[model samples]
Target: MPTIRLKTTINAPQERVFNLSRSLDLHIASAAKTKEKVISVKQTGLLELNEEVTWRAKHLGVYQNLTSKITQFNFPHSFTDEMQKGAFKSFSHQHLFEKISEEKTQLIDVFEYESPMGILGKLADKLFLKSYMKRFLLERNQVIKTTAESENYKKYIST
Candidate 1:
């Protein structure tokens, strides 16, 4: 399996940025090309370790439903989600946030996904999936970064 890690810095407070970064609704909103559904959310212990969420979304014009459980969480610093079921052979996305200044946070996203169909998968990964997938994730993150830094987003999160 191949892992690609990307990092970006966003100008926002730790608490504010973390809250927005971890929001499922906000994530969906940032992706104009894709739609998502939340199958469930634990009313209590949200943003806490062990919290689980079930959701489905469209990517590359394909719908993939998944149940992901929060494997790790520390109030806002870092967290990980492991997919229970999805289109990929395996999937996981880990988000890390570090306060660099009073109004800035370093955001790191790490992802691991496996393609199906062995030989075809190998071919796709090498031939096309690699660069294309990286761009897809980075563009999504850019959207998140842009939205999170907006004045409206700040006001909404503050309220």
Candidate 2:
């Protein structure tokens, strides 16, 4: 398994950042470049514990569908989502939020995944998969940071 960690500092409340991170609408908007869309969802709005969402998107010129469930959640703090069905052998993402100040917050992402095909997967990760995934995450984080720092967050989050 390969793990990718990313930290983003946002000029916003920790609670707001946390909510935006889990917002379905925000996620779809951020992934517009990949043409990502929701195929199905257990519930809408911000994802809660045990909620599952299926997303269809084009990656590497192939359209794929991935279903993931929120396995752990701590309000305004942290959450973990694991893949139920996807291209990867296993996938898990942890979202953590730390309050830096009344108006500042730190958002952290810990993504761990194992590609299929064993040795082939290892080779793929070393060759390009890791960097590609990192770039994807970076783009998503940038959108989250921008949204959390502005009034535009109101479009995705209610509270």
Candidate 3:
């Protein structure tokens, strides 16, 4: 599996930042472009352990549907999700939140994915997905940072 890790320090507390991370709505709103691609996503079950979310999106020039269930959720700290379908041999994303200070928090996104083919997979990864994934993570992080700093979210949350 090829792992991509992006760590960012956000100007917010661990709890507030963690809540924002759990808000799928905030995530979609932050990433302006990807918001358009996604048709809809909803959490029908309890959002704790093993909760499932149906994600519908158009990517790679096609309509891609993926179901992800919460594998782990430690409130105001961390969570993990495993992909049920739609591209990649295995996809698991871990989100970590750490209180660096009374107001500052560190947000880390660790993504691990494996391509299907053997040798060709490596080539595709190096040529395409790896860099693209890095950029994607960075952009999403930027959105998160902005949203976290916004007045609406910044009000009750310490940052």
Candidate 4:
């Protein structure tokens, strides 16, 4: 499995950052370039622990559908989601939020994924998939950071 660790500092509260990270609306907006959409029934809005969601999107010019489940959750501190079905052999993404101050929060993402095709997958990972996934996560986190720091976050979270 290949691991990707990233940290993003947002000028917002930890609660805001955490909520935005799990917001269905925000995710759809952030992945607008890929046209990612939630296709699972009875799964929308803020995702909770043990909840599963299926997403359909276009990646690498190929259309794919992936199903994931929230395996762990701990309020505004941390959460973990793992792939149940997808192109990859397996994947797990952990979201961690640290409160730096009343107005600052650091969002950390730890992503690990394994590709199929054995040796061919390893070569692809080494050659391009690793960097590609990193770029994808960075873009997603940028959207989270920007949205969490702005007043627009209110549209995703409720009081």
Candidate 5:
């Protein structure tokens, strides 16, 4: 398994950042480059614990569908989403928010995943998969940072 961890400091409230991170609309916007779209969802807006969402997207010239469930959630603090069905053998993404100040927040992402196909998967991870996934995550975090720092976040979450 490969784990990627990232911390992004944003000039926004922890609550705002947390909500934006889990917003369905915000996710769609962040992944626009991949043409990602929701195939099904248990609920719209900010995801809560036990909620599941299915997404279809194009990655590395291939189209794929992935379903993940929010297994753990703590309001404005942290949340964990685990893959239920996806290309990966298994995966868990944890989103953590820390309040730096009333107007500043630190957003952290911890992604751990095991690839399929055993040894072949290990080879893929070493070749390009790990870097590709890291880039993907960095882009997503940039979107969240940009949105949270500006008034655009209001479009996704209620203040």
Candidate 6:
């Protein structure tokens, strides 16, 4: 498995950042370039513990569907979501938020994923997927960071 870790500092409250990170609407909006959308569920709001969402998107010129469930949740601090079904062998993402000050928060993303094939998978991960996945997470986190720092986050989370 390859893990991609990212840290983002946002000028916002921990609770606000945490909620925006889990917002279904925000995630879809962030991935607008990929045309990603939730396919299995119509519910579009903040996600909670044990909640599952199935998303369909175009990546690498192919359409893929991935379903993931929130396995662990510690409100305003951290949350973990694991893949239930997807292209990869397995995948999990952990979102953590630390309050740096009254108006600043440090957001951390820990993403771990494994491809299906044996040696081929390893090669793909080493040669291509690693950087691709990292970029994807970085883009997503950038959305979260920007939203958290702006008034747009108000639509995602209530203060």
What RMSD, rounded to one decimal, does every model reach?
A: 2.7, 0.9, 3.2, 0.9, 0.9, 0.9
lDDT-based ranking: 5, 2, 4, 6, 3, 1
TM-score, structure 4 vs. true: 0.97
TM-score, predicted candidate 5 vs. hidden true structure: 0.98
lDDT of 5 by residue, 69-157 (tens): 99999998999999999999999999999999999999999999999999999999999999999999999999999999999998999
For candidate 6, give the lDDT of residue 122: 95
Q: What are the models' TM-scores?
A: 0.83, 0.98, 0.84, 0.97, 0.98, 0.97
Candidate 3 structure quality by residue, lDDT tens digits, 1-159: 899998999997677778777666655565455443333345321256786666665555566676777899998789998887767788999999988997789999999998878889889899997898788789878877877766666542333
lDDT of 4 by residue, 1-159 (tens): 899999999999998899899988889999998999999984457999999999999999999999999999999899999999999999999999999999999899999999999999999999999999999899999999888877888889974
Q: Candidate 1: worst 10 consecutive residues by lDDT?
A: 41-50
Candidate 6: Cα lDDT at 61: 85
lDDT of 2 by residue, 92-126 (tens): 99999999999999999999999999999999999
Output the better candidate (3/6) by TM-score.
6
Model 4 C-alpha RMSD vs. true structure (Å) is 0.9
Clashing pairs in 5: none
Q: Which of 5 and 6 is the better model by TM-score?
A: 5
Hey, what RMSD does candidate 3 come out at? 3.2
